[model samples]
Target chain A: MNGFAIVWQERALFLEGLWNTVSLVVAAIAISVPLSALGAVVLVEAPRPVARLARALIDLTRCVPFLLLAYVIYYGLPQLGLRFDAWWAGLVTMTLYNAAYLAEIFRSAWLALPKEGFEAARAYGFRPATLYRRIVLPQIAYASAPLVGGQIIVMIKDSALLMIITVREISFAANSINANYFTPFAPFVVAIGMYWMLSLIVEAWVRRVASGARLRYG
Target chain B: MTWAAFETLLTGAGTTVALSLAGLAIGVPLGLALALIRWARIPVADQLVATYVSLVRATPLLTFVLFVFFVLPTMGLELDPVPAAIVTLALNTAPFNCEIWRAGLTNFPRDQLEAAEACGMTRTLAFRRIVAPQLWRVCLGPLVSEMTILLKATPAVAVIGVVEITRAASRIGAATYDPLPPFLAATVIYTLLIAVIVQAQRVIEALIARRYGYAAP
Candidate 1:
């Protein structure tokens, strides 16, 4: 039988894997976006010591590999009497890992904004919270959308690492198919194709969003 | 952690560094060749290189590792874990490095090459003397960052049974029944390795900038 035929016969398994990957990506982005936004804000606008500390923490976290970070969270946390299920552990690891990159992206966008806008908002008697909400956040969101989208694609790809911790993602499904049929190429190539398609869709969506934002905001 | 655990982790780290260096050694030349082919605008080859880069970038490094380590054996090209890891990493990194090198090439001033050719220099001589130096300067920062990324990705080889630092930590963790200490040690070691790479990048960037009589911004 051809490789595609083999993969077709295992369509259910592949679909399940794809679904798991999507779910993991969604959950991770939902958790990380707000957390990273807060982190970016602190890194950019907080007091000197606080900003320095946030920057250091983000740097340190980024230096560690995501696989190791997952392993640490999955295995190491149990020692502290804070055990989590493999799914939750994987989710937490993805959030923490991607949050650092997202925060850096957001921080750069925040830094690139002109200072005059913030001063103008302040002159209009807008407090820090209102100023950020009414002026800064919208600008950075539009400016950073493409990069944020790219990072989301990255998060989707990195979700495969969760299979190492036994999260039963697509890679895990592929491994099982490989083990059972001894057909490594079929399952993995299928998974890679799925990942590629997902990323292409994201890239297209991001492009549309960017152009739309340019027309609307500019 | 015990002294023995530290030793084990260090040994694994040594393997990680060695593998990463070997991968870079192969990948840099291959990537530069791809970039040059595209830059020369060899039509079919350029399209093929573009497709390769896009496909590789879209997939995770883990997939590459698994494919190389597993599928190749069926085609009678069996490899041990370390070499398999190195080959997979080199293949994965080549596409990224190609993009980086291409970006650097965009910064190359065309007039210098034109002038060199007008002055009777061979294409090879002109590129060797003029274009190559500036290309290295433009590419160095991104290349170093990519190397650190490749180094960080070394742990992915553990899935194929290679005992890199992360794998070493897991083994020690299982044996000692204390996962935190070994993982903590791995974190520190990884952080230090990245710090060294970043520092080297800065020093090299400064040196190149100085050689060109320009202060690094």
Candidate 2:
């Protein structure tokens, strides 16, 4: 009761943290999904050596832990004459880590598409960019909506790790409240509830879009 | 990184592997048991299990890790860093495995069990002889993926001072003020480690498929 009371008293801090977390995820998804689509297209359409290089990089990003990658980007980059503020570094790392995962997803769905559609687009004399824009992207996006939703939730969760680099995201704000009020349980549980709510909303939205895609495209 | 730093990272990687394996060992069976409880539809127990899975699936591993490490002590269940980490990993992964196992259980062909019962096989024997192998064959791929995710999550334990590979990298960076070498080394180690897991999964999946005549999955 006392711990929760403290959390309620500092509701402003939690709300602020929640907002930062939302902004990070929205920004990360905006950047990562386009980048992922580009990477996926490259993997499927590029020449052998270039495709292989893309595959290797995607696999590397997939295997590396997000937190470790963030640490590297935050601490190691300056040595290479690259300097990003911790906030931008967090966003960039989120983009890098989840882009690989989403790219893998999109790439597989792209491969699974029927060969006739692609060949038909080619024979119609459609430009390469037009073929991709009209045929390739829409089909993959529909097929991959559910998985992309899952990854979006993952990105939301991973945003909490940015607190380690002093980004003052939800978990950081909760932790600071703990540091001040010595109420660990209340603040973290509150922060996590917000995350859970965000995930549910994303999932519901994905379901809506997927059903619509099915009606329109399937 | 110097040779000493390399040695330190190796040691940290070892700890990471050990913790993840221990967590997997506990989580797999625990998940199976939970799935069974839900499958049986035993009144309140089934509903409890469902809620537990949903709740766990909704939260992040780091939030769960922080909760166990920081909040558990106030409830009069204090634990050291390593044990707390193992607990956190096991708790976090079990719900995922539960879902995987439940999928196999629900989708299992009911006629096989009926035929076994008509053959006068006991319920235990029917499950042991028929259901278990097929479940393994069905669940192996997703189970392995979960294991890899758990391994990737080991770094979250570092917050409470477990000094796994990522933690060691951070420490080395702090000591030398040049994080590139150690972090790069850590990345290589983690990549190689996960590759081993994936490769082993391939070997195991091939074996299971051959033994069970796996078809679609």
Candidate 3:
């Protein structure tokens, strides 16, 4: 192939990897948000032992490297007679990791809510469920949007770890390309560019949503 | 699965802890220096510092490890996996620690420094006697959290062939033709170590706060 042809081929390969990265991130984040919200509510509303256990679990989950977690779930589950379909290992592991972080973000936002607001709702004869659904959840989402957005960005970066678990994600695809080409610079650099672009998009979207919420509620 | 192999994994835990401590030893001082230089508003250096920090923060840790291990060989420096892992880990952690310390230093009370200057103390002496101690108090939480991060991040070093717990687990997996037992053992060890570190951080932070008469929540 001529130089221009080779360059075009590399670009195509890179774009495909970029698309994969985006899809994986979307899949991970799409499911993670609600799971985290529910997990956060449980941690906060449950008794002291439950809260302590939840916090410990979050810390434990966050401590292990994503690659190691991916390895465990990918390879360890089958031995326990629980074999996931292709892509499930990566998705499940990433979701679990992101959920832990998202839970912490939501928990902090929950704790930061004005006690007076809750008190007023309670005094007005609102049930706990009604108080949470009507008054508290909205405020917590507003307060936690940027932080939760940041966590999602971190989660996207972490999805690269799924490559180790045999997921044909962006980094894994890039690595295969590099192996065939015998040059690390092109494929790896392209992957980095993809990550940078995706993260920039995430940050911009987060800012826009934050401003929209402010305009609506301010 | 055997007790004997479990003992080997336990030995590997020591390697992980040692690598983490080594990274901390190098990273903390280097990070503090970079933080000071970056925030000190020096001539022509501030922009460079900011750029360096941005590059490090934006790149994935895996990329950093791959570059250091694979690319550095062509540059005439032949570093072993452990050293390479340490270099990357320390470099990765430094930018974070630098930012944390810089935030602490910048947010420290301005009036106290002014008061020290008004008392006719030299600038270095003022920072030493007045600002540094106060900065420590403000930075305590972030510092503890960053250390916890360092401990947590040690597992990444395994990627470079360091015989840390994760690396050891990989070895067992490869040998046994089974990944579960070793990986599960590593996971348990990792979870336990992290719990211990978190608890230790809380205790140390509480002790420091109490000694300084500052209430810890």
Candidate 2, residues A67-111, lDDT tens digits: the string is 999998898888899989978998899989999999999999998
lDDT tens readout by residue for model 3, A128-176: 8999899999888888889877777667767766665566666776667
Q: How badly does each model clash, as a count of residue pairs?
A: 0, 0, 0
Worst 10 residues of 1 chain A by lDDT: A1-10
- Scoring the B chain of model 1 against the true B chain gives a TM-score of 0.94
Model 2 alpha-carbon miss at residue A86, Å: 1.8
Model 3 residue A75 CA deviation (Å) reads 0.6
Candidate 2 TM-score, true structure as reference: 0.94
Model 2 interface DockQ = 0.74
Tell me which residue pairs clash in candidate 1. none
- Clash pairs, model 2 backbone: none
Q: Report the C-alpha lDDT of model 2 over B63-141, residue by residue, as the tens digit.
A: 7788888899889899999999999899889999999999998898999989999999997798789998678778988
TM for chain B in all models?
0.94, 0.94, 0.90
**What fnat does each of the candidate structures reach?**
0.72, 0.69, 0.41
* Per-candidate TM-score against the hidden true structure: 0.94, 0.94, 0.88
Alpha-carbon RMSD to native, per candidate: 2.0, 2.0, 3.0
